[model samples]
Target: MSSLIEGYNYDIFISYCQKDNKHDGWVTEFVDNLKGELESTFKEEISVYFDINPHDGLLETHDVDESLKEKLKCLVFIPIISRTYCDQRSFAWEHEFIAFVEQASKDQFGLKVKLPNGNVAGRVLPVRIYDLDDNDVRLYESVLDTVLRGIEFIYREPGVNRPLKPDDDEKINLNRTKYRNQINKTANAVRDVITALEHYDHEPVTVAKDIFKPASIPSETGKTKIVTGSLILLALIVLGFFLLPKLLKSEGEPEKTIAVLLFQNYSGDPSQEYMCNGLTNEIIGHLYKIKSFDRVVPIDYVLPYRGTDKKPSRIADELKVNYILSGNFNTTRDTVRITAHLIDPRKDKILWQNGFDQPYKRIITIPADIATQIADCLKTNLTALEKQNIERIPTTNLEAYQLIQQTKNQFNTRTYESLNQLYDLSLKAIDLDPGYADAYAGAGSMLILTGTTFQHTAMQTVIEDALKLWRKALELDQNNASAHCGLALYNDWIIWDYIRAEEEFLKAIELSPNNQSFMKGYSEFLQKRNRLEDARAYKVKAEDDPIRIDILSLVLSGEKDEAHKYLNTYLQSKKIFAGEYFIWLEDYEAAKSICEAALQKKSQSMLAPRYQACLALAYYKTNDHHKAQMIIDQLIEKSDISLAGSPEFYTGWYYSGIGKIDSAFYWLEKAYKNRCPEIPWLKVDPGFKNIRSDDRYWDLYERAGHKAYDDYRAGLKRRKSNR
Candidate 1:
């Protein structure tokens, strides 16, 4: 029998303070409302398990470990941070919060096996239900600084009347608005942090140094010493001219290469861990605008060496780059000091270095100054408008600046919890200054991530809210690329308005040419329109990250060998699993094998679901219909209906393999109508060779809108004749 609860799969795990629950039943009420909202939002009636439930049989039977283990196996820990919640004695707080952090870190960084038993743990969602002072949070300062740095903390107004009370609709509405805004901000923050963590773990170092070296001191006879010094200098110059170009050649082009290293944190408070990342992102954003530069990779590409014993020269050699830029920020209460250096990687010497200090508000101009300084050193000309654009600050508010940094951190993490955190933070920034367009844009992105992950019940509402926020953002700032991209994605996925999506995507690309997301999204749009050549071209122009390049190459070539080669290089460089890379090669069997191996090493990965789907497809392809059906059925039952598409596509393949022509046609028709790119392979696929002679097969092929198939053959003959 097909079962939904074959094993303990958790929807939510509630972490709350027993003390807070003691007074006025606040925790209980919050839990009830949250459960209702999640269930209503996802359309799945999920069981909400709490650590503090008094009548729990597991507690009485001394099976807390076993029960909690099972609970953790299927759990998404929701930490409710309040004043009392942060209290160390709160066992509910300690057990849940610690366990959640450990699990989440393991899931994210693959750190599960570090424990004694070497079992992987699940992820956690830290939800702040009430306000807590900095001091209260400080008690668990280390934990907060590490796991909860980018988490969304939902806060309710203190002394607000209870919702259960009569005639409290006004307060309830106010509180609901507050909670909604908080929830939205947290959601956004969670998404940002998760995305950052997933993508930006490596920091790229841009080589910076003083180009003009100090002249060597002369001996007593200065005139006589000039001969030796001049000869030495001349020889050095000659050696550089002959050898530098040959040594610094990149893979394709030999343009100036730059790497933005991790920014130094000036903030003395260790809790403010995101400041360095924020600074790094800002510099990267500015540099990304210079189109004349052939390649500018982010420090994130080299994150594996963070805190390692490797030198900058070693890293540069591995990346095969020419330059590295390093910087430090020192900030006081009212002033900020910044120092930066550019180095030549080949020479292992500093080419340029500079320092600047200014009032906190004036730090925005640092980008232009740094850019101009580096440009002068490199002998690259920058237009006046580019200089002005570099200096421009989107917002003057310090809070907004801080919020942007926090949002960026959260965005990079790319987990559900991180998305929620980003949303909450962005919402708070918006509330602080409703005129802040970027905050709204960030919130919209959070909504999109959330909808993409959960994809049911409240998805429409979430997406609509995202659109409204993006529109509001654009209304405030017409040229906001982030807002434009957010709207484009919203239109493309939720609304299915491809034309509008295309327009917005183009506008975003025009505004921010080097933005990786915009490039990838635009490429996908081109592919959707059957513009494969255009898609391939754009994919080449997009950022050359391992995952992105691998997927793009697979889409363009459909050659497993090429895909595998690229994926192997990527794996060697990154020293990590590339799950999506395996999927792109259509080597589902290999992908499934790797994922299973990873799971055995660290079982609690969210990647399991995605890989499970891949395995099902592989089984279907190999004609193991029963196994494929079993896996697909389980996935459909456990996951959202959107997951049903893949299984359905495979079902058609299975039917076709067994000579069920009518059923095969039914499935293939559905797949083709959905514009499944994989559907085209059916025309040339050996699995369906049996049906090639059928007249109905030709009709189905025509229905798939591949007129180019005939055109390509004719063009081939014409080209041969001409040759």
Candidate 2:
């Protein structure tokens, strides 16, 4: 902990009305961007307090008030003021704002303080989202008795009266400077105020001569020394009795940060690799159940290191972990041998090593056995929930579990043929054990991959089938994270149930908090919804999968030049998102080259068709309608009503690029009707520019549930005069 934060429970507290967070979430975005800006501004970790549940009832509940009072010992308080925020007699204003004002005024240090920059500001920092009613404005002034010189997030242009919407990012409007810049200013102001507060708190306490007279004793120093000495003795006694034991217990414990490298396959058969990988994944799953663990490297991040010559020490350095778990698995016809080692990478010492042979039928217990051993070695206790998780088995049938494991391993390949085989194996597992939740989850995943991997003639049917499998899996076991993820995808993409999708996504994360796939999927979902700031927050959580989402972060942060540089480096190994970046940067030739190259290299890949779609769009941008039309015809031939909705969206993109508004609108409508997940991105998509003026665009946009698009279209008229 930094000295600046020693006395404060939180560096910042965000106060806002629940209504301001509705409709794609304005308050959510504001907090996300502010948190990011603060992280970038400070070197030390900063704690921010924000309560999402509006009905947590700060005044009604004693527990809530106790928590809030402790949190209110913060360095800065940010109140997001809007018309709704001011007018409503909500806890945000009456309990939080007024309460904090009264608390700060009666404090010994006072409410107003001179900052290091020679400016006096109150502790309650206001953030205006709208020019409020005169009476509302007077309310804040009357409480604080200072001019409300707060940060403004809204466009204060002439004739403009509403808050900024997400869709304003699309068009090149002079008044629309990047939203991040306004967030930066607010974050910086909060940081300044916090620093000044820290300085004030750290200042020496001075006694006023007029307030208190010294004792009329000749030996004043002698009396002071006696009192101070007695206090020191009392403190030492308390420290010895209570705090020393805990300090010593913590000191002797191992560092909680660890990374598990991919388990080596000693069977010497490439076909049996899946079993080893699955064992490794199961071990990691068990490890994450331990609440005391700060960080446990996920399997996806460690998979690339398998069969490589990389040293464990170097791996630990890259992962920023103190300990490493490495082991190997070898299986015979009816039994398996496992050797495990825990190493302190920095010192190159093996803290623990063990070998065990267990019957193949009892393979499901291996993870729990290993996790228990490691927990004992580290002197960590397993909570009841974690213990139960370790003991739970996915299926009674061992063969079915093995089949599910093998199928999951195929997903790492990311090829059309591999996914097809995975789908077949998943069904085989389900046939083997109909009551198996893991098998059902595997089956549901296969359906989604199949919909995305192939040219589907009936995409909706495939998605519906997948959704049924996900529900069945949950019926078998409500704690299945994979099933929750499958349902989240189906809800977001197929059913267009935005709220349900978020709920399912959050449920998946709650079930398996360390899973990177759920994190990445939710981040992408937020991005498509034009909640880039929220996307950034999730992207930070999904840091293990860096290459997958870095481009989007750079582009959204107004770092196109940096994104281009990264794209060049990123394209060296894979061409998977390079075309999208090139398109965003308006480099049609570069986009065309990469997409064409990928199509030629892996023509049978599930991703190849999407790359081909990108190629067609690039060709259209380059005015090569002849080649672009030829590719579009091929895609149309392959696409049916049942496939994933990508083909329809790409077709729409091609038509929109070529100035065919009717055709573009037709395909876009089809995309929406089919529940194409890509439809969520339509508002911010560059290709939609030419058709945005058409009434049909608004119709489809509204049908796609993008209120931001409607708001942006309405606000375009006031752009030029805002400056």
Candidate 3:
């Protein structure tokens, strides 16, 4: 009978006693509503098995239906537990629940699967319409050896408990909401289990112990208890040895990768370019809420594709994605028309396409609808929570959303005035809509970027303001990934709370794992702690992002040559990186040449002093102390007024390179106090290794919140010995 069905015969099997169905037909109505919701939730047709005929008992001589036995191979076994259902030991309990339980016991019975919250949950889901008695709970929990958790449908009034009906909520107005919530929960749970099962890689599960077979008639009550107890004991042993370990590992598969291409401007008016760009950016943001995607190429990365004559497959290869989403937008007098197409680049096929032509006021709905449609076409298993997150529009105010999108477009312009202007725009967005979460997140990011702007406020005051803005953003939308990422940066750099910063970064990644900003921050955080291998893994996870490729993990891992090769191949302006690498390799001539070339290219750039300092370091290494000293003196005078934080850090570098240990420590401490951005590179930057033998160097390292893996291992060893 089990062999009759392939992967899954039914999406869900609803088991209930006939008496519940007779009681105002609650079961029938519930099934009907569930079917309707299933249709709306799933792209494919959902097959649900609900036996309507009342068969109170199954006699020993009564022939069992082969079709019923075949239908038991369902993805989800939703036992509609009620007082009558729990008390009976007939077809509901025997053939429906126990039969499937026995079959699963022979498979990976207790292997925990990943949940939407990055946790794990079991497979057997229950829908409770009546309170479970002690016996009812024992029978189920014994076989599973876990709590009998379910989506409970019993409504508790002041002193009464009753099954929730679809139309019974006149006073509280919560019955319908509760029912819908449970349905959604059940549907999403089934999806989670199926996804985990499809992706899980592990040893085969088998029952080594004796298998108990039921007689022609069901087992006697005492015998049933013994059988169930033995199964529970064996399950405990299996779980202790197997399932517990698998819970810590993730299920693996080909990652769901996507790239959002630049939206074409069909709006004839070139002055409305901002609107078209904003719409494209907003669509990307909405798509980011779909946690199923492993990568979503950010707007900046895909901007080059706007006018290029590249094929979808070629662009997909460049972006390293399985799918590409491109669209066109036209803004008319009172309406906007947006068309979206999702292409499978491997086959150069259009998998899904849709268009929305709506009034300007209703424009906010377009992104959500487009994201949902793409997910449906890709067959992405979105949980109810993820679906709600994807559908949530940031704000109803078009001006607020438009302003925030414009800020995203201009965020890369990291000038003092440009960033301050972006901050002002964010404030304007918030004024238009006080509850806009993205506006607050945008404002916080701009404040963080323009931290050195003396035109507005001090760095400390800017940090505090940015922190508050991010907090407000989280208050408005707790699941805002950008808000979490901004807070992660604040905690890491300003507050120096390494543990809290890591937690925030991880939370942001969990909310939107494909976001490059979160991935880069996490990589830098791991690097700061001197976890080079761990940092490298995160760097590779975000390798599609050009900015993230400049991490120091490769050089720190003693692969400086590999780093140099990558820079030589990938970066067009590789002189600065090559100079850094040559300094690490002790090739003074090569380092000096690279630095001189970089300075010649941009003698007036903000980083010119840093290049000059590097050249001086190379000069000192090559036994040219006279030239090195002259250049260092010129830099110390010329960079005295530079607003950029590089002057302090490079001054320390020049001193350190010339073997002036005390002077190096003084300038390094000054840079640390000044909150130079280069402080994060202290652990991996080879220049700092010169003074590692000094106590002051260790003190500075500790102040920078650095730690090694050996430190953690030593702590573990101490705890173990104490125990």
Name the best candidate (by TM-score): 3
Measured against the true structure, the TM-scores of the candidates, in listed sequence, are 0.51, 0.59, 0.62
**Could you tell me the lDDT of residue 151 within candidate 2?**
72
Off by over 4 Å in 1: 1-254, 302-311, 348-352, 376-388, 413-417, 453-461, 495-500, 527-613, 620-623, 636-723
- CA lDDT scores, all candidates in order: 0.57, 0.70, 0.69
lDDT of 1 by residue, 463-514 (tens): 6678778877765666678888886776555444444455578667656656
> Tens digit of lDDT per residue, candidate 2, span 1-723?
222556666777888888778665888877887888888998877777888766423443433455677777677788988887764356787777777777666664566655674445566788888756435664576566544548766652323545665455512321233466668878787777777766775443221111111111111134655664665457558757454345333565556878888789898877778888888888887787664565678877788788879887899989888889989989889898999999998899999999989898887888788887887787664543456666777787888888888776767644337555777888888898899887888787877776663444344667777777777787676667888888778766765555546656876765565666787888877766665556666677667445435566666567878877877775665465777668766778988877777777775542444666778878988989888888898777655633443777778877887789999988888777767766777776666778999999887777775764335423432431231
Which candidate has the highest lDDT of all? 2
Candidate 2, residue 38: how far the Cα is off, in Å: 53
- Deviation from truth (RMSD, Å), model 1: 28.4
lDDT for 157 in candidate 2 is 32
**Structure candidate 2, residue pairs in collision:** 456-643, 457-640, 457-641, 457-642, 458-641, 458-642, 459-642, 459-643
Better candidate by TM-score, 1 or 3: 3
lDDT of 2 at 540: 78
